[model samples]
Target: MDVLITGANRGIGAGLVAGYRARGAAVIAAARSGGDVALDVTDAACVAAMARALAGRAIGLLVCNAGVYVDKGERLEDGFAPALWAETFAVNVTGVFLTVQALLPNLSLAEAPKIAIVSSQMGSNMRANGGSYAYRASKAAATNLGRNLAKDLAPRGIAVGIYHPGWVRTDMGGAGADIALEESVAGLMARFDALDMARTGEFLAWDGREFPF
Candidate 1:
């Protein structure tokens, strides 16, 4: 199997890439700074270029995991500064949309094509507690984006889903979160492998439970 992961330098994205690589899957990792797949998700041209370069190669798993927070500790107005919100959404939302759209040609060849967008519980309106307005709004959009993509792409046999990795102890999640990055990533990847057409368009937790949209 072949896998493509975005924002794969540290934390969940990087760990997931490592896990998949350990399982012997050919991996293509993307990041703004650098990684195995040095493409930036924010750049449509870059994603398109990378996808074209891969051509007819099959990508069994496509993890649209790249995301950012202006700062987890501050209020969105300052933490996700007005200026930064644009870039953040460009990376966190539009990036995933464009990357997946661009990679469709390459993804079509996979025997079991699966697409996962890393979302957050902050995006959950049903259980919202407030704060991080920018991050929450952008992810809410991504969650729905995954749902729409799942429905549109199901006829082609590709399964698309969104997941909340919980408050994983990553740089963005900070050191205080209750869950470890390894635990969250492991559970999410396991769920990804077990998904099928019936589960498409769903919002699920890392531990394999479904969440209301």
Candidate 2:
């Protein structure tokens, strides 16, 4: 199996790459700044270039793991700037769409393809907390995007699933978060492994429970 993971330089993304490789899958690790493949998902030209480079390769899995949480510590009164919202959405929401759009051809080449979107529980309407508005909104959008893509891609033999990787201890998740990187990655790979057309469009957690939309 061939897997392509974005933002694979560190954190959950990096762990996914390592775990997949250990299982004997050909892993293509992509990152915005640096990795096996240089891909800035926010940049359409960069994503297009990446697609061109991997034109003939079949990607069994595409993990849209690249995202941003710029509103982590921002105050509601003074910290949520307009530019910050734009910046966050560009990478967190728009980036996911662009990556999927560009890689559709590669996915189609495979007999069965799956797209794993690294969304968050923050996106869940039922689990809405007060802080990190921009992050939450972008994640919600990403989740919705995955749901819609699932509807559109299933007929083409591509399954799309949105997942929350738990409150992991990464640069984005913080040290005080609920789980370790290893735990989150292990759960996520299992979730990815279980994804199929029958379960497409489902919002699920890394631990296999269905997440509330």
Candidate 2: count of backbone clashes, pairs at least 3 residues apart or interchain:
0
> Model 1: which ten-residue window has the lowest total lDDT?
71-80
Clashing pairs in 1: none
Which sections of candidate 2 miss by over 4 Å? none
In candidate 2, position 11 carries an lDDT of 94
**Which stretches of candidate 1 lie above 4 Å from their native place?**
76-80
Model 2 lDDT vs. the true structure? 0.93
As for model 1, its CA RMSD to the true structure in angstroms is: 1.6
lDDT string for model 1 (128-187, tens) is 878777788898999989989998999899999899998889888888998998899789
Compared with the true structure, the alpha-carbon lDDT of candidate 1 equals 0.86
Clashes (backbone N, CA, C under 3 Å), per candidate, total 0, 0
